[model samples]
Target chain A: MRAFRAQAAAELRLTARRGDAVLLNLAIPVGLLVFFSLVDVLPRPAHVAHAVTFLTPGILALAVMSTSMVSLGIATGFERQYGVLKRLGATPLGRPRLLAAKIASIAVIEIFQVIVLVAVAFAVGWNPSGPVWLAVPAVLLGTAAFAGLGLLMAGALRAEVTLAAANGLYLALLLLGGMIFPLSKLPGGMRDFARALPAGALSDALHGSLAAGGGVPGRAWVVLALWAVAAPVAAARLFRWE
Target chain B: MHRSDHPAISVSGLVVRYGDVVAVDGLDLHAEAGQVLGLLGRNGAGKTSTVEALEGYRRAAAGRLEVLGLDPQRPDDRTRLARRVGVMLQSGGVYPAMAPGEALRLFASYYDDPVAPSALLERLGLEDVARTPWRRLSGGEQQRLSLALALVGRPEVVFLDEPTAGVDPHGRVAIRAEVARLKAGGVCVVLTTHELEEAERLADRIVIIEKGSVVAAGTPAELTSEGGDAAARGGTGAGGGAGVAGVAGMRFGAPPGLDTAALAAVLGAAVEEIEPGQYRVADPGRPATVAALAGWLAERDLPLADLRTGRERLEEVFLRLTAGDRGGAREEEGR
Candidate 1:
């Protein structure tokens, strides 16, 4: 337990110190939220009374994915390449603890992301309704889904390949996830594909609580739960240390 | 069993294979507590593979390995093995942004009782650069920091992978001192290095390996003299094996292809021109033998350059042993 805490703390310290991590994980989603809310650039989804109402929830989902999946994956990929994972594995802080530490640190960063994004959303003239606490479970499930996918890629591929694939997937999900544009805006097949994706499911789930007319999102919950469970199990079974 | 009775590290018929490449082949080695064993082999000679298998990072294809009396390969003993063993990889295991101070403190946290991070920094002469990030530190400083991390856990056994390979002279001295200090504390150390002199200075026993198996194992003194007399009198079988047999021979520059058979007759020992214009008298034992060589060369009107005669240097013995591995010691084989 002590080794786990130290590893997590060290991982967090390094992540906080990295310039790209700060920009990608914290600045991008928050910056995009503020930018679109004030700029009147969004296509404006149907029945969304305030632009901030829709944008805030979607951006929070983006923020969670950015930190939990994309950022974590890239960092772990490089760590493996540098042999840091290998070295730490040889210590009392074994491989299982090392992984748990990374997830713990990512969870911590996500909490901060939520507080900042939510605060900014409130400042930008948005009103959340209908079980706002439900967003908490939604965010945690989304974090697990993305984290597992991120680790799956980072563990199975080379660092350079992971970097390219993760960034590519992040952009693809950003447009398809209804963060800026709803899935309805995408073409027929593309719309269905986006809805099936974890990012899209996460965005829709967050929208159920943080946006008006919020209610239980049964379909989105099912999608998030499947990915939350499946991706992690796959990553655990297939991840290679070297 | 008592600590002295059970060796700190024991391996028998160890084999490590990567696909079709056999890295460690039927190797055996043992080291008692407080012993420093130098594993000497060229690049791709399986030194790292052997160490990795012992460290439990790589699974052995065959044979038994025990460290601190625990089988490293057993999953049940992983945490136990980790707590007892500290490993220093060759390079680049640290996070690029982590400073030496942070790395030391973080790794120290893994053990029950660790050496103070600050004290380890001071011991390794890394105090000045403690705040500097790992990638920004000099190569030598990075190496010292690696060593410091290995020692921080206060492990009973330590495995160092070329600890001084790229270090500067001053850093090398500091690392050597730390290794000596570890031995003084009764810690068992197994370090892999191609640096022959470092082995001579630090290793209680040196194991020279080639093709994933030990070719020679002895104290530096014993190895230098092991094959000497046998090699002189038409001994040693086949290509390029141990040179610089026990006693020292006078090697002086002269005409290539000297009549060595006649010279050996006169000196009552073996003589050969190991290289063009370089002659080796296998048993240049007495003061009179030295005079005889000069007199022999003078009578033949042959010029002599440097006459170096003493106990054979470890370097000479090392070259002879490894030369065979390269398949280029035909001259030594012919005689």
Candidate 2:
């Protein structure tokens, strides 16, 4: 337990110190939230009354995925390459605790991301009507799903490959996974594929809970739950220490 | 059942294979508590593979291996033994963004009882750069920080791979002193190094591996003496007469074209002009032999430039052992 805390603290320090991590996980997400909310840019969906109202939930979802998946995955890949993972593997901290600490640090970072994005959204004249209680499960499940995928890529691929692949996936999911624009905006086949993706499911769940005022969507919950469980299990089974 | 009674490390018939190529082949080694076991080998001779297997970083292809009397590969043993063993890898175990103090503290937290991080840094001469990021530190500084991390855990058995490789001479002395301290504290150390002087100075026992097998194993004194004896007997082996020529001969400098036969008859040992104005007395340690040589030089008014008795150095022994078997294995495979 002591080792876990120390490892998590170290991970957080390292993440906070890196300029790129700040840009990707915290700055960019908040920047997107402010940019899209203030500008009349995105084509609002038929059911949505205000652009800020619709985009807020999606931006929050984007915050979760960016911090937990893209940034975490690339950083972990480099950690593995640099032998930090191997060093921890030889310690009493072990693999499981090392992973738990990484997850905990990601969750802590996500909390900060949530606070800043929500504060920014409120300032932009956004109002969320749905039971805000549902957002908790959506954010936690979304973080798990994305963090799992991130660790899987970090562990299985080379650092350079993981870096390129993570960036590519983040962009693809941002456009097609209903973060910036709704699934209705994507083409027919892409909408179906997007719904199956964890990114899309998370966005749908957050949007349903926050903007639409309907309880968390049942289908989004199921999709996200499946991803949350499967990705982490697969990552655990496949990860290589070195 | 006592931990102190068991060998700190024990390996029997250990084998490690990468694809079809066998790296460590039927190797056996042991290191006792408080002993510094120097593992010496040529490139690709399986030293790293053997150390990795023992450290639980690599799986053994075959045979038995135990660290601190427990199987290193077993999950339960891995967790239990981790606290008891510390490993310093060849490179890259620290995050580049982390400060040296932070990295040390993080690793120190892994053990129930650990050396203080600040003290370790100070001892390793890293106090000045305690807050410096790993990538920003010089290569020698990074190496010292790695060493500090390994020792912070207060491990019972430590495996250091090239611990002084890039360290400056001053840093090297500090590291050697720390290693000596570890030995005094009853920490078993197994180090692999290219520096023969380090091995001779620190190791209580030395093992030289060739082609995945130990070709020579003994104390520094014993190995050097063996090489000296071999040379004295005129045996033509690897490193044959290379540096060992000093072991069986008395080297002295004087005018060339001397009457060596007359000198040999008087000294009761063969005397030969080995180089221009240089002479070798076959056995010069005897008082009579030295007296006769000095008397002869004094009588001839020949000024003696230099004189010394022969004792083979460790390098001669290492080269003789490793060099002799290099081609023998390949030729056998070809045949």
Candidate 3:
């Protein structure tokens, strides 16, 4: 347990030291959210009184996308390439502990990411109508599902392949996850596919709570819960240390 | 630090295959604590494969193996065995963005009880660069930092794969000295190298691996004595006492040229001219070989031009043993 904590701390420090990752993961997402809300180039629905309310949940989903997929995939892939994972594998720090540390550090960064994006969302004009506490479990579940998928991509592919694939996944999630645009605007087939995605489910739940003035459905919560449980189990079974 | 009476590592009939390349064949080997075992071999001689298998990084296709009394090849047993062993793999690289001290501390965290980073850096002569990032350090400094990380776990056994491969002479001396200190501290060290002097200076016993089996292994003296005996029976056996000279033979190069009669007079019968240009110089006290030879040669004004000496050096022993063995064939073909 002590070794796990130490390793987690070290991983967090290393992650924070990466200037570009912070810029891309934390800074860029918030910047885009604010910039898009200020300009009306992209059409907005007339009934939507404040675009910030609609934009807030999408921006939060973007935060999850950057950290859980892009950051986790690229960093872990490089760690395996450098033999860092191999070194850790050979220590008293067993696989379980090493994995726990990775998850813990990512969780820590996600909390900070959430806080910064939420603050920016409020300043831009988002006003919460339902219980804000509901977003906690929703964000936690989203992080797990996405991080697990990221690990699967990282552990099974070459670092170069992971880099290309992760970027592709990021762009697809941005479009189909309904983070930048409304899923109702998509064609019928694409909207059904997007709704099944964990990102889309998470965005729907958050948007219902703070933006749409509708209650978050039990069905959407179930999808998020199923993904939270399944993706990590898959990652744990198949993840490669080196 | 258990006091169990067992070899630190024991292997029997180990085999590993990568596709069609059988990296390690049926081989039996072991190393005890408090001794430095040198694994000497040519490239692709299965040295790395064997070591990786022992470290649990590579699974053996067939073998009965025990590292620190645990079967590392077993999937469930690997983590238990890893806790006790430290590995400095050749492929492991430093995080170039991390400071030296930070990197050491990070690796140190992997063990329950680890050596302090400050002390390790001081011992490795890495104090000046402790605050420097990995990319800013020189190649030798990076190598030393790697050594420091290996020692951080305070491991009972350490595996060093080509620790001095690209290091300078001075760094090599320091690394060897540190290894000697580790031996004195009762750590079992397995060092793989192609350098003969490294084996001679650091290994209490050397194992010569050819293709995947142990071709020769023993204390340095025992291996060298075999050379002396072979020289005694070779073509120049007429120089009976020349066997004792045992200066390691040269196959293609011109032999040393020193006046034997003049050398014999200088040493007062201690030096005997057993054959032309080949003199048997004996020092009962085991005086420095070169300095005494030079003094004796100078006293007689003998042009010590090409006085070829013939005793088996470790390199000759290695080359002779491994030169003919095929990569996959296990049966020995030559003496």
Candidate 4:
């Protein structure tokens, strides 16, 4: 437990110190929340009254994905390339502890992201119609699902390839996963496909909890749970220390 | 769990393969506590593979390998073994963004009881770079940082792979001193290096591996003395009693065509004219041998130039052991 805490603290320090990670996980989400809310670019959904109210949940979902999946994946991939993971394998902390530390650091970063994004949303006159506390499960589940995929890529691919893939995936999910605009904006087949994805499920859950003041949807929870369980198991089986 | 009589490290018939190519084949070696075992080899000689396997970083295809009397290849033994064993890899064990102090502290936390990070940093002369990120550190500084990380846990057995590779002369001296200290603390150290002088000064026993197998293993004195034995033996058949020179023998300049038989009789050991004007006395440490050589030179009015005893150097022995295998195509890759 002590070793885990030390490893997590060191990991968090590195994550916070890295300029690219900070930009991707924190700055970008806040920027999107302020920009999209003020610019009026998002086509308002029929049930939503204001763009900021709709974007708050989407922005929060994007924050969770960016921090847990894209940023974490790219960082882990480079750590493997640099032989950090291999060295840790030789330490008393062991593999499980190292993974725990990484997950813990991701959770800490997500918490910071949430606090900052929510503060910015409130500053922009956003009001929640749904039970805002329900966003907790949505964010936690989203983080787990995305963190699993991130680690899988980081462990399985080269650092440069993971970098490109992570960024590309982030953009694809942002545009097509119903985070920036509703699934209603997409055509019928695409909407169904997007809804089936963890990214879409995360956005839907966050929207239900924060925007509509409703409980998390059961389907969204199921999709996130499946991804959360499957992605990490796959990553563990495939991950190489060196 | 503790076996006091067992070797600190033991390997028998160890084999490591990268696909079809063999990196280490049928290799066997051991080191005891408080001893420094220098593993000298040419590039691709399987030195790194052997060390990595013992550190539990690589799986051996076939072998019984043990460190601290525990099987490193077993996953269940790793956590316990890691606490007692510290490994300094050839490169890249630290996070690039982490500061030296932070790296030390983080690694130290893995042990139940650890050396203080601040003290270790000071001891390694890294106090100046405590806050410097790993990527910004100089090569030598980075190497020292790696060493400090390996030592911070107070391990019982340490495997250092070229610990002073990029270090400056002063830093090298400091590292050597630290290694000596580790030995004094009863830590078994297994180090690999291309530097013969470093090995000579540090290793209690030296093992030279060639083509993934040990070609020679002995104390520094023993290996070098073997070269002297070869020279002495080679001359014995030709000069009879006139060429039985050991490593302590002295050579001096003399006039050409001087009578060596008389000198051999006077010294009571082999005395021979190895070159045109150079006379060698087989045992210069003997009072009579030095006296006879000096008296012979004075009587002949011969001026001795380059008069020095023949002490075989470790470099010569190492080259002789590893000579034929140099510049060959690598038998395997992926160390």
Interface RMSD of each: 0.9, 0.8, 1.7, 0.8
For residues A170-198, could you state the per-residue lDDT of candidate 1 as single tens digits? Answer: 99999999888877678899988888899
Model 1: how far is B102 from its true place, Å? 1.0
Candidate closer to the true structure by TM-score (higher is better), 3 or 4: 4
Per-residue alpha-carbon lDDT of model 2 for B1-335, expressed as tens digits?
Answer: 13556789999989887777777778888888889999876666778888888888878999999888899978888888888888888787999998899998999888888899999988999989999999999888988888888888888899888888888988898889888999998999999886789898889988776667766677877666624343221222223233332244576889999999999998989998977898888884677788889999999999899887755567756765566545543211100
Q: Best candidate, DockQ-wise? A: 1
Per-residue lDDT for B70-142 in model 4, tens only?
8999998877788888889899889998989989999988988899999999999999999999999998999
lDDT of 3 by residue, B44-152 (tens): 7678788888888887899898877888878777877676777887655566677889988887877778899999888888889899987788878878888878888
- Model 2 ranges off by over 4 Å: A213-217, B1-3, B226-309, B324-335
Model 3 iRMS (Å) reads: 1.7
* Chain B TM-scores across candidates: 0.88, 0.79, 0.75, 0.78
In candidate 4, what are the lDDT values of residues A1-242, reduced to their tens digit?
88999999988988889898999988888998899999997886787888898898898899899989998999999999998888888888988788889889988988888889889999999888777787887788888889989999999999999999999999999987777798778989998888888899999999888876456779888998888888888988898768
Model 3: number of clashes? 12
The residue pairs that clash in candidate 2, if any, are none
How accurate is chain B of model 4, given as a TM-score from 0 to 1?
0.78
Q: Rank the candidates by TM-score, best first.
A: 1, 2, 4, 3
Clashes of each: 3, 0, 12, 4
TM-score of each: 0.93, 0.87, 0.84, 0.86
Q: What are the clashing pairs of model 1?
A: B225-B246, B228-B245, B228-B246
Report how far off residue B110 is in candidate 1 (Å). Answer: 0.6
User: By DockQ, highest first, what's the ranking?
Assistant: 1, 2, 4, 3
**In model 4 chain B, which range of ten residues has the least summed lDDT?**
B232-241
